[model samples]
Target: MALTVELDIRNPSGLHARPAAVFVKAAAGFGSDIRVANLSTESPEVTAKSIIAVLGLGVQRGHRIRLRAEGADEADAMAALEGLVAAGLEEPLDEAPPAAPVA
Candidate 1:
C-alpha cells in the first residue's frame, strides 16, 4: 500500500544543502520507496532518497510538496517525514564561545 501526505516547506533556507541532506537521510532510514513532488512548481516526483533529485525539485519556503511512500513501512515513513517537516528542518546552532573568561 502507498501512503501520501502533503507537507509545507517551512525551513527558513528552504530545502537547500543541509535540509536536503537531512531529508534524504531520513527518507533513507525507511524501507519504503519514498517520492516527493513540488506542488507549487508542478515538478515531477522524484525519489526522496536522492539529494540531487530532491534538490532538483526546486522547493522553496511556503511551498507545499506531496510525499508518497510505498512499502511495508510506508505509514511510519510518512509519519516521521511529516514530523520532520513540521519541525522546520531545524539543525543545531553553533555554540557561542566564553566571553573572554568574564575578565
Candidate 2:
C-alpha cells in the first residue's frame, strides 16, 4: 500500500535542523519507504526523507508538505507521520503513546 499525508508545517521555526532531524528520525522508524515533499513551492528537489533534501526545501510555518510512504506498513507509517505533524513536529512519533496499541 502507498499512503500520502498532507502536513501543515506548524513549527514556528519551520522545518529547521531540529524538526527536520526529528522528521527524518521518525521516517527512519518505519519499515516502509517514506518521502516528504514541499508541494506548495516551486522546488521539486527537496525530498522530506533526506536531511539535506528536507533542509533544501526551506519550508516555513504554514507551508503544506506532502508525505508519502510505500510498503506493507504504509498505513501505519502515514498515521504515525500525521501524528508527528499534528504534534508540531516536536516530539518523535515513537515517544508519543498510541491511542490504541497495535496488536
Candidate 3:
C-alpha cells in the first residue's frame, strides 16, 4: 500500500515557482513513485516530481495537499518531505508567484 500524508501548506506564497521547484527536486531524489493532489482545489493527482504539475495544482497558502508514495523508500521519502515542509519549503513569504511556467 502507498504511504500517504496530508499537509496544510503554510507557506505564504504556497506551492509555486521556487517552492514547487524545491518540492520537485526533493521528490525526484527518491526511488518511490510519489503523487500529490491539491485537496482544497480538488485538482487531479499528479506526480510529485514535476514542477509544472505541482504548479498547476494552484496551491496557495493554507491549502492542503495530499502526498502518496509507494516503493522501497516510500517511508524515507515521506519523512524527508515532511521535514521539507516543516522547514518552510524555503522562504515563507519572500517569493513572488510565477505567472506561468518558464518553458
Candidate 4:
C-alpha cells in the first residue's frame, strides 16, 4: 500500500543545500520507497532518497509537495516526513552571540 501526503515547504530558504540534505537523510531512514513531486513547480516525481533529485524539483518556500511512500513502513515514514516538513527543514538559528575572545 502507498501512503501519500501533501506537505508545504516552510523553510525560509526552501529545499536547498542543508535543507535538501536533511530531507534526503530522513527519507533514507525508512524502509519504504519514497517519492516526492513538486506541486508548485509541476516537476516530475523523484525518489526522495536522492538529494540531487529532491533539489532538482526546485521546491521553494510556500510550495506544496506531494510525498508518497510504498512499503510496510509507509505510514510511519509519511508521519515522520510530515512532522519534519511541518517543523520546517532548517535548524533553528542560535540567538546567543559568540563570546569575546580571551585577551
Candidate 5:
C-alpha cells in the first residue's frame, strides 16, 4: 500500500540542514520505500531518507512537498511525516541550545 501526503513548509528558513536531517531520520525509521517530490516546475523526485536529496531539490519556504511511501508501514510512515511537515518540521536540534549563565 502506498500513501501520499502533501504539506507546506512553513519554517522561516525552510527545511534547512537541521530540519532536513530530522525529516530524513523520521522517514528512515519505517521499513518502507519513502520518496519526496518538489511541487515545483521540475517536480523533482528525491529520496526521503537523504538530506542531500531533499536539499538538492531546492525546496524553499512555502514550497509544497509530497511524500509517498509503499510498504506494510506506509500508513504509519505517512502519518509521522505529515505531522512533522505540518508542524513546520520545527524539531529541536539534537544538541541542546547553549545554556545561559546562572544569575
Candidate 6:
C-alpha cells in the first residue's frame, strides 16, 4: 500500500532549486516509488525522485503538498520525508532574519 501525507511547507523560499534537490536526493535514497503534488496550487503529482518534476510543482512557503510512496520501503521513505519537512528542509541559512543594528 502507498503511504500518503499532506504537509505544509515551512521553508522560507519553499522548495526552490536547492531544497528541491535535497528533497529529490532523499527520495532517491529509498527503493520505493515516490510522488508529490502541490495541494495549495493544485499542481499535478510527479515523481519525487526527479528534481525537475518536484520543482514543477511550484511549491511555496505555507503551501500544502501531498506526498505518496509505495513499495517495500514506502514507510521508511514517508517517515524520512516527514522528518525533512519538520526540519524545514534542514533550515536554510539564507533565510535567517537580519541582525539589529548596534545602537
Supply the TM-score for candidate 6: 0.87
Better of 2 and 4 by TM-score: 4
Which residue pairs in candidate 3 collide?
Answer: none
Q: How would you encode candidate 4's per-residue C-alpha lDDT over 1-103 as one tens digit per residue?
A: 7988998777766788898898899999999999999999888889999999998999977789999999999999999888888777656533354458999
How well is each residue in 1-103 modelled by candidate 2, as lDDT tens digits?
6777777777766788998898888878878888777877856634446798888888887788888888888898888878878887883334332357669
Give candidate 1 misplaced runs (Cα > 4 Å).
Answer: 92-103
User: 1-103, model 3: which lDDT tens digit per residue?
Assistant: 7999999888877887998999999999999999999999998899999998999999998799999999999999999998898777886553455467779
Error of 6 at 62 (Å): 0.9
Q: Say which prediction, candidate 1 or candidate 6, comes out ahead on lDDT.
A: 6
Tens-digit per-residue lDDT, 1-103, candidate 5: 6888887777666788988988999998999999999885367678899988988877777778888999999999999999888776775423333458999
- Write one digit per residue (lDDT tens) for candidate 1, span 4-69: 999878775679989889899999999999999999999989999999999999897778999999
TM of each candidate vs. truth: 0.85, 0.78, 0.87, 0.85, 0.82, 0.87
Sort all candidates by lDDT, best to worst: 3, 6, 1, 4, 5, 2
- The reply for model 4, stretches above 4 Å from the true place, is 93-103
Q: Model-by-model lDDT, in order?
A: 0.87, 0.77, 0.90, 0.87, 0.82, 0.90
lDDT of 6 by residue, 1-103 (tens): 8999999887878899888888899999999999999999998899999998998899988799999999999999999999998787776544564468999
**How far in Å is the alpha carbon of 3 misplaced in model 5?**
0.7
Backbone clash count for every predicted candidate, in the order shown: 0, 1, 0, 0, 0, 0
